[model samples]
Target: MHDAATPSRSQPITAGVLTALVGFTSSFAVVLAGLTAVGASPAQAASGLLVLCVAQALGMLWMSRRHRIPLSLAWSTPGAALLAGTGVPDGGWPAAVGAFVVVGLLILLTALWPHLGDLIAMIPAPIAQAMLAGVLLSLCLAPVRAVVDDPWVIAPVILTWLALVRFAPRLAVPAAFVVALVVIVIWTAGHGGPTGDWLPRIEGTVPAFEVGALIGIALPLYVVTMASQNVPGVAVMASYGYQVPWRETMTVTGLGTVAGAFAGGHAVNLAAITAAISAGPDAGPDPKRRWIAAETAAWSYLVLAVASVALTTLAVSGPPGVVETVAGLALLGTLGASLSAAVSATEGREAAVVTFVVAASGVSVAGIGAAFWALVAGLVTAAVLRRR
Candidate 1:
């Protein structure tokens, strides 16, 4: 585990490839759903996915090697949840794209100002997790809604997900995604003359800035990505004894997000859950060697980027409830973790509960969504009720 190394150094197949595979397969459906939820067309969605992968791959590889740590990168799933849960602005998808740019800039700002990270860190963990819980609650209900409305199409997907969750936990979401696609293909084939084009189509959208979208979408996206994704990403590395140059990595993630959003992608940030897979001892006996695991992720992500775009096409073209159903199944574990974290602290339990309820309600006032209000309400409550 030397700080300095040479090109002749070899990487292991076991750690590197497995981490990449797990990261990609586990969450790509949710990424697709998030893009679509914000009104991205199929082509635009593919562009976003492709851009996100390539940017994260390049950024993560460079950072990990520079620091000699497994500095993995991932898109913000919770930010996607926020997008999925929010209503689009009058300015349309272009406006949303504009908001994504704002989010990127804000991330970059936070990186430069350590005080901003400190403010987010000051928020109770419970409240932050509660806000995320609220954002995700609706998507979590999607599977149930699909079952009640169309059991036949939705049943197979749910059953497959459940079976995999029980028998092979890590593969559950990816298998569910596969089941949804197969079900869509079979149903389409049975009903009519071959479904529409299945090939990936990449399209670009020129962003148009809108004030409403900046407040409603961009602000919340920045807050959640910083609090839920990047902050935790830092903690995960540190938990495994890695010294993260927080400012440098955030600059990379922030810049990466800006680059990706130009092609309609949402926010890219530190990999929280997946970081452990690469940073842990299992990545290799020598911790320095683990950055190879992340470097492999970079290469694998580029390879998977092609398939990711194709899968996005399939998910968007699938049956009505099918895509959301797959997305819900994919995020189930994340939802559980958020819910658990939301209640882990007793002092802020009531405030966090308020935050969760308001966020889950999807209330919108003056074009601003519940995620913001939930945070406000919870913070005020926590302040007022202190010592009670």
Candidate 2:
């Protein structure tokens, strides 16, 4: 009964489904790898994933409901990468839990203080856009990289994506995801793809605070989550002309992070890459209707939270880059838009370029990632060249 003038269900359906698929496929492995590296057994890692997914779903629901924007929330992927490299704290996973609690408290502090959110919001628009481009640079390369490594599996997927984009833009990412999923299932049928349990195995640990974990894990995790994830997340929304209320975004995620830690989840923050996906025109031709896409994403996140065990099993068992390739392809449009925004204003062009390069470099100092430095570099460049 739907005509061309009437909205296609595909818009919301694809937006929601892609949001969930991208959330799971892209960085779930990085999170799992991080948890395991921190001395979490299999059960503990799965538990962490489940709790984080649920936490993110809750944050998304709250934010989207209050603000009416497609504001997506996610666990800190860079923070997880940090944990993977940061040696296990002295008291093991329990110590890590305690560190998570500390991070939650710090996040809460900013949420309660309007000025803190304002401080983050005050970051120049071009630099913010550049930082976003930098953060997403590596993940956006997966589609091409996959062609080099596994062209047969990836070629059909990308082809389908390209065709859909040309003729059926709304369904592009979702269709690509379906294609990728089928190929993974068929190829991994007996190939020993990452195989294991996919059941919600809740592993509870009493938090044990350690000074070492606080300084090494908690502080750095807090910084990275704030700078790399939350800050850029705000930027992505701004790029699309949506003004997200930073206070609500921070308060909900901060509290959610605190609650999720008992269940072994880590820092929860605003999503940077996926936000662009949901907030963009692909979610819907009409910007007003895009919030529906975020609402759909919230529902999908909750569903995935319940199915975290199964999703984890599939993620670990997939062909090495299958998930990442899909993630990159899905995000290509957003990346292009971000690049355009970064370079659009000649006034801040030089600063934005420095920000993009440094942020893309993935350089870290004292365990802090480059997103913050990218902002700093861009700001300094702007300041130094102000007279020119």
Tell me the tens digit of each residue's lDDT in model 2 across 158-266: 8988998999875677677678778878888879665777667788889999776777677657766876788788899999989978777778888999998887898
Off by over 4 Å in 1: 1-11, 191-202
Off by over 4 Å in 2: 1-46, 58-103, 203-249, 261-300
Candidate 1 residue lDDT tens string, 1-388: 4634332244433566777777776777777777777788777878888888888899978997787788889888888888888866658889889899889888888888988778877888888889889989899899999999999999998999899889998778878877887987787766662323345445678898877788878887888898888878889999988988888888898899888887988898998988887888767667767888888888888887777666665666667888888778777777888889998877778999999999999988886778888888889989989956
Candidate with top lDDT is 1
**Model 1: per-residue Cα lDDT at residue 42:** 75
TM-score (all chains, Cα) for each model: 0.91, 0.68
For model 1, state the Cα shift of residue 130 in Å: 1.2
Native-referenced Cα lDDT, model 2: 0.77
